[model samples]
Structure formats: structure tokens, C-alpha cells
Target: MDQVQESYDEFNLNFRIEDTVIVNQTEMEGFNAFFLGNQSTCQQSVVEGVRVLSYKIPATLPLGQFLKKQLYKGEFLSILSNILNQLLYFEDRNMPIKKVLLNTKYMYIELSNLHVQLIYMPIEKEFTDCNVCEFVQNFISKIRFADMQCVNCVDQILHYLDSRLMFSLREFYTFIIELQKEDILKDDIDLGEGETTVLQQMSYNNITPYLVRSRTNALIPIEKTEFLVGKSSECDYQIPDNRKVSRKHCSFRISNGECYIRDENSTNHTYVNGKMIQPGFDVMLKNDDYIRMGDEEFKYWVR
Candidate 1:
């Protein structure tokens, strides 16, 4: 196996936990019967009816075996394929869940008007362990099917991907999502409270809703940074000065550390921590680094 493959194998074998949380009897019952083949039996009786099924599952039953019944063979196949493909072809980027909440108000009415009955339970973590548990959680957490027709949300996702001119829908969607995470190492980390954390500064024009920085010095735009953070190694900003000033410049050289600032070579110079830096000088920054350009003064933080 290649070195990357070997590392991934090691990670899967030793680091990541495969199981997710699962609760509920119906799903559990369906899962058991599907996997154990309805062989071992148990019994149940209600006010109106009696049902016989497998005896209580032994506590020692393997999680993989339990989930095997609850999860489809096809689901297993697809997950395995994706994992192998990602390991082989893509750099793993940190990402948050891509969720689509169904519009229960209007869409449900429309479906009901059309006599289309929809029933779906949101995907939940299975209590039992399995290799694809994380993948399952990622998939289910990202998808929501309401009383409305399933096609509606799918169409929206497809259109969004198409609008981006994504060559491969799956890969592009995944990459975009991964790149959109709030970077802890960034000069500006907004915790959403009265407090702010600045890891680095972007140029004034590159300012984004989630971050505050000057864009005039920004070597790259927030849109591109939002999509390229963890996936690419191409540097957008260059250090004009060999002299390191403060924590900001040093962070940029470290792995996973990133910052944005206006270049001194341009018409404007980026001032950090009340110091006006000249062209070609590198500055190190920490949380709450104060930057000034012209009349504007801003603070950066980690959110």
C-alpha cells in the first residue's frame, strides 16, 4: 500500500470511533430483523395484537452485527467507496455539516394537496458501533426530509451545485463545505458574544460577514479563502519584509496558521498593534490584534 493508504489504514484502525448514538425501538427492531435474518425470535403483545420476534439481543452482541441489520448493504457499499476515494484523491479538509431543513409550512401543504403522503424519520446516530458511523452521521445530519416531497430539497441542492459550475457535484459540494468552516487560526474569530478574537487581518475589501479585516491588503478575497482554506497550499499573501514583527507573521509560517493583511508595497500600509509596518516587513499577531489603515481601526479575535 502507498504511504497515504497506510496512514489512513492506521487512522481507521486506531483513531476514529465508528459508532454513533441510536435510540428508539422501531428502528432497533427493524435493524435486528434485517441483519439477524429473523432467525432468533422474540415475542411482544399489545392491547389489540401479539407479535413474536427475536429474544432480547445479548448485551454482548457486536455493534457491527446490530448495525448491519439496520443499515442497508447499499449504504455500506457507498460509504466504503467514498472513503477509499477521498483517501486516494483528496486532501481531507475540516468541515461542518451541510444541512438542509425542509420547509414544513408551504411545502407540506403542497404535498398534501397533491395527495402525496410523506413519512420520514430524520437520520439519527445508531447506538451500536460500525465502521461507517461517522459517515452515516455526516450524511444524515446534512439531510432533512420533511412532510413535503423529497424532490424539492434535492432540486435545490442540485441547482446550487450547478450554479457553481461544479464539475463533479459530490466532490465540489464536499470541498466547498469543508472550506467554509470558521478557522480557529484565523486573525478574526468571532465567538458571537461581546468579545472578539483576531487571529489575523484580511484586507479591507475582503471583509466577510463572519470575519472583519481590511480588504485593500488582502492578497485574496474572502470568497476564495472561504473555499480554499484547508484544501490548497498556494499562498495568496507574501511577506515583503524579512523582519518578523509580533506573533502575526510567525503564525503564517506554521502549519494550519493563516492571516490576511494589506501589503505595504501597495498604496496603503497595514498597521498592527499600533505599529505602522513598512513594505516587506512581517508581523506576528495574536488574538485581539489591533490593526489600523487610514481612519479605520479594527480588532481581531478567535470565535
Candidate 2:
């Protein structure tokens, strides 16, 4: 019965689109011809190669009026489907959507229930994997208020939504872009026919830990064998303003190309990715891991 139920559940699950669309020989040939023809033009002007699409839908049309119109709901759904499909297509191709603008004619969509306009610009890059819809959804989910203003500027929209969200989004986007660049650099350096690059070998030999301070946006390279962290001035990495931080909070060190952090028997203790670690016990550090010392938080990056 359990196995049967599991099978039924699996059958009912709506899977996310993950695979790229397969093109036929004719489609491929046409794409090649188009690419070759436009190569010169695209090289000359980058903006000309970018595609921008926009759609407007009456979201606030009264339910009664919409029902009376008969095909309003269908039309609305169709437009939304097209937008989603375009986003998914770009995502599959690893293309960055340059911009996505959402507007409701200078009125809040929740208040007016009137209309929604979506403007999207998709720009193809040699290597980019940004899902515009996912970013929008993630950003929207962080909005504290149900009522949102119809704003043209993405930064303005975020400002109206939440400041914390804006800061977090900026940091996250930067981190992702940096990671992508690192991956691209690694590929360029390492990719060859049966040849291992020196950079690739060095990556395995060395462990470089980086501490990204949230408040100051300061990036500190961890080169020493042991780095002390605390609120006290005596500590290596001092957070004097942070009252929650103990005098001698914690310490981190790199050993055999692996980074480890050990709690230093502090008042508030040390945490890695939210879970508190045992005092004096060393925890192995991973790339892009979050570390919390008392009330302060730091993003750890190992390169």
C-alpha cells in the first residue's frame, strides 16, 4: 500500500522544466544561417543583439466583468504562460535577462487590481546562467507588505519593498556572479586535450580562506595559520561595536588544504550555518559557508 501510494504521488507531481528543447536539422540549419548573417552586426553593436519583450494585462478587470467577457481569463493565462516560457527558454540557454520591469500604471496592483505590465530584456552571453523568473520570485517573496507600488526601476521597487531584501539581493547577486566568473576562469585555464594546468594543481595544493564582512563589505584574506575573532581589540579580527561578541570568541585555521573553525569558549558561542559548534571542537569549513559569532555574521569563501 505504501509503495502504491508513493507511485501515485510521484505520478501527480508537477515536474519543473529542466531539459533544453531539442531542435531538428532544419531548425539547426536556419539558426546557423541566421547566426552567420548577424555575426558582424552583433559584434558591432551589443545592444542590437539583445531581445526585449513586453506585455500588458488587465489584472484588475472586475471578476464579474471578466466572466461576462468570456475569454478574459484565457487571454490572461496565455500571456502569463508565454512570459514564463520565454523565461524558461532563456534559463535553459544559460542566458542572462538584462532587465525585467513590472508596472501597474503608477498604481499598486493590489489596490487597483487593474493592470500589470511586464517588460523583459534577454541578452545572450558566451557564459551566463541567470534565471530571471527565479530572481524575481525570490525578490518578491522577501517583500514584507502585500501592497506593492508599481515602480519602473528595479532598485526603486526593492527600496519600497524592503531595505534588508535589497541588501541581501545585492550581496547574493554579487556572490553568484563572482562564482560564475571563477568557474569560467577555471575552465579557460584547465580545458585542454589531456593536459593538466598548473593553476588546477595549485588549487589542490593551497587553501585560501576569505572573510566577507557584512557591514563594511570588507574582504579579508586569511593567510595566517590561526586567526582570532572577538569583540576585544586584542583579537585578530575585532568587532568592538558588536556587544554580543565575547572577548575571545573563536578561531579559524587552514590545515592540509582544508579550513577549520573552532569555538574559543566564548559567552555567546560560535555557529556555522546556524548550528552552534562545541567549544574547542574544530569544524571543517566549506566554500560559501555562513559563520555567526554571537550576533555578528560573516560569509566565508574558500578559493
Candidate 3:
């Protein structure tokens, strides 16, 4: 097995709890208010539900003070509440819940919409045995879901939770890297000598350049092969106020769904995070990389 897969397996085996209680659809009605209507009412139901569920936990299991310290310090309660609110929102909106699995350490909510599954694990050593009720109460009270359509609801919730949940961002970044590696391997195996020779030209033709403006925070989706960035009126991305900017600053080219920036040999030059790229040479841009032309700065991102 590859290192990534091996690490993933190890993480699951060591940190994950095996047993889970699957909540039935018929039993979902009691929590309708929690999902569909009033926030206060929904929160109350969640608190009560967690208390009942806690009864199943083995009292003989050793309780450590360290665990309690971790729970209170981190955003475990907040994360749990956000997840429950999202699940309830899904349930109330007629979004099918394929399964709701509750374990001692985590909750997995599976939705029929896109077959998306959200796993929420509380921070280790954070919850004291005596603090479960308080945790639940805090979690429920903090939940405030905005009214949004079910289509992108899961993604929106996951995006919000990504910032709060520990290990989530790292896991997601690792998954993306694995996917990119697999894509490269597949490309290498499937290409013929003649086809491979033309691959770069063909791939360049198929690319779409997507960028985010740092100052305005606007998304610029580029469908063209080449995009010009400068102060000139003809440029695709114009920086008008920056006097240090040249008339034609830099050029961004889309190749194989990837973006590359090349300095147009402007007076002030172009840089990626303070590192100046030699004129006429392309610098491949990655997500969250800062691109600077003269004194003006922009952040590069892929959608």
C-alpha cells in the first residue's frame, strides 16, 4: 500500500470507535423543531437527546481529567452543534438521511443528496464525564443555520466546519494531493507515444483559468487561453490606481486546467510571494499563492 493509504488506515484503526447506533427515520420526527423551525426549541431537543444517548456509555470506562481539559479548551461543542443543526436542516428540508450513526466519540450523518457523508469527531480529552450536559447545551445554543437550498447545504456546512474541526483541513489537503497523484499516474499509463507528443498542446487548449481578486474578493473565471494583467484598458485584469504598475504587467496562461504566470518584462517586474520570476519564464501558480505585479498584489486560487 502507498504511504497515504497506509497512514489513512492507521488513523482509522487507532482513533476511530467501532460501535455505533443508527437512528431510524421514524424516530426523526421528535427532533423536527430542532431541524426545521425555532432555534431555541431545536436546541432543547438536542440537549435532551444527547443526555438520553449518554446513558449507553459504559460507566466503568476510565475517565481521565486530561480529556475534560481538551474538550473545554477546543471548539468540540461548537462543532458538534453545527453538525447536528446541519443534519436536522437536511431532515426538515426533505433531504433523505441514508443513515445517522452515533458512536461514543463521533457522529456520522449520511445524506441521500449526492450520497455525501459527514463525519464529526469531537476533540480527544476535551469532555469531562460530568460536562456532557454542559457541552450539549453549549453546542445546541450556538447553532444558527441560515436558510439555504439543500443542493449545496452539505458543502456549505462542511466549508464552515472546516475552520473549526481539528485534522479536517489536513485530511482534505492530503486527499486532494492523492487524487492529483492518481490523475498523473493514469495519464502516463494511458498515453501513446504519438498522442503524448501532442498532449501538452491539447491540454493547454482545454484549460480554464480561474482567479480571485484579493482587493475586491471577486471571482474571475477565465475561459480564454491567455489573460493579460495590467493597468492598460485592453488588459483582461486591470489595476488602475497603482502608479508602479506597467501598462502591460504580466500574462496568465491556462494549460491543462492549471494556471501559469509569466512576466511580460514589465518595468517593475512580476513576483510570486516576493520571489521574482525571470522574464519570459512561466511560473506555475498554486492555490493560495500571492502574485504581485509592481506594488499591487493578488491572490491566486482554483475553483
Candidate 4:
């Protein structure tokens, strides 16, 4: 029964489009010629031996109203089918173009309810060196999300650069949510608001999920290690405890070889290794690392 239910859900998502444009060939002076009845002229011309197609769609009536009527018979899919066929025909020629511009000004005239986005071909090499066509093809082929192994969703372009190029997380997360429904790093990820968390319930000896140095809370992932240090918030000359837990609610633990500290946004800044962190900065913990937060100081020892 579960298998059958899953099959039903799949079928619902892969719904079929019934309407489509019928393409036909015609004898012409240049490369190719065709027409949709007597409504518009479709001509494929070669300029300097490069094949290019020029077609026009009539907009005698307002396009917005016309599209509203067309949607009743599922004409949208039919139009897409026609456009896709033309693209495939160009692909068969073995000639590549940098960008394909579809005139959608008339589309806006009749199709108020529908929206269109223009995708340019031959993406910038600076951004991953993969063209827009390659990006789309990769998405259609071997892309999967929702995995610890898979780093990025196929629907979005993955351009991994150093932290220097990292943009605002807000803008990044917005783009991810559009391509993939889940954004794990979102600020409001918790299902419900609570006074205390599971980390508080777990014993520090058994599982220390977070570390505090200088009041900054750094979340510690299991099997990761980090460094510890101390410094004076009021004066640089002053040093704090080497091992400090933030807020008494959480402690840091290292399982593998990375150190981590959580930000409780304390008055004194936590300095991981040598980098002084703001309240929210998640400090990277490393083995034998130096950390100084507020009046606390510590050298991390790997167990």
C-alpha cells in the first residue's frame, strides 16, 4: 500500500501536457521556412553562414486577455513545446550560440497570469567556468539534494570560493529556498521556541555540544576539535580562564580533531587562536589551539 501511495504521488507530479504547437517545413529562399496558418511569418535565415531563425507572433488583441483564454485549453504547454522544438532544431545544426533571446513582450500582453524568465547561454567563466547550458543540463542529469554526501542542490549553481567572496547569508539562503525547500542554516530553524534546549539536558561528560570562550557560544559538532584561549575584555593585558563554559548551559567537546565554540554574545570577545570573534561568530576549534575570551584563557588539549 505504501508503494502504491508513493506511485500515485509521483504520477501527480509528472502531469502530462496535452496541447502543443505543430511544426511544419516549407520551401524558402534561405535556410528554413514555416508558418502557423496565415497568422505569422516564420523564417530561418543565415547571416554570414550562421543560421538564425526570426519569427513573429501577432498581438492584435491584448496579450493578457488572450493568454487568459488560452490557459483554459492548456495552451501554455503547447507554446513551450514549440519553443523547445525550435531549440532542438538549432542544436541539431552543431552550431553553438552564446545566448538565445525569446521576445516575450507580446507574452506579457495576453499572459498576465504567467511569467517568463530569460536564461542566457555560455555562463561567465569567472563563476565556476560552467556555461548556463551546462548548468541546466547538470540539473536535469545527475543532481541530488538532501544528503550529507551531496554538498549542493542541482537546481542551483555551486560556486565555492573562499570566505572572502561569501556574500550575505540572507541573500544566499533566499536563493536556496527557491531551488530547494530546505535551508538548514536559517536562523528560525527550530520548530518551536523553548526556554531550554536538548543540549542543556545532555551531560557535559557524555556529550558537550557547545563551547564557550569569553562568553561567545560556539557549537561543537561531534568528532570535531578546536582550540581554547583567553584575553581581557576591559584590557588586552588581562587574561581569562583557559576553559570556560558559556552561560552554564552548554560546554564544548571535541570528538575528532576540530575545535568549536558557541556565541552567547557575551560582553567580552572570544578570540579563537588569534582571531577575535564577535558575539555570533562560531569559532573554529582546533587541537592545541589558543583561545582567549574576556578574562578567561585556555590552551585546548586533544583527548
Instruction: Give Cα-based local distance difference scores for all models.
Output: 0.30, 0.46, 0.44, 0.33
Could you tell me the TM-score of candidate 4? 0.21
Estimate candidate 3's alpha-carbon lDDT, on a 0 to 1 scale. Answer: 0.44
TM-score ranking, high to low: 2, 3, 4, 1
TM, every model: 0.20, 0.34, 0.33, 0.21
Give per-candidate clash totals.
43, 2, 5, 40
Model number with the top lDDT: 2
- Return the candidate ranking by lDDT, descending: 2, 3, 4, 1
Name the runs in model 3 displaced over 4 angstroms.
Answer: 1-208
How many clashing residue pairs are found in candidate 2? 2
Cα deviation at 255, candidate 1, in Å, is 17
* Candidates 1 and 3 compared by TM-score, better number: 3
Candidate 4 C-alpha error for residue 80, in Å:
44
lDDT of 2 by residue, 1-303 (tens): 001111211111111211342213332222223221111011111123432221122234322233233232223333233344433333345433333333212111211322222323322222222334344445333333322221212333344223221112233343333433444565577556977644221111233578898778888787777888887788788888888899889998754334678999999989888999999988866568898888788999865
16-127 per-residue lDDT for model 1 (tens digits): 1123423335533333342211122122322123221213322222222223333332232233233323322211221111111111110111111111111111234322
Q: For residues 18-39, what per-residue lDDT tens digits would candidate 4 score against the true structure?
A: 1232212422221123322112
Taking the tens digit of each residue's C-alpha lDDT, what string does model 3 give over 1-303?
A: 001111211211112222343433333344333332112111111232232121111122111211232332113323344444555554455433323322333321221111112322222122211222223334333434332222233333344333321122223333333433443554577555655432121111122346677767877765556889888999987888888888899998754334678999899989898999899998766557888788777887654
**In model 1, where do residues sit more than 4 Å from their true spots?**
1-148, 158-220, 225-234, 245-303
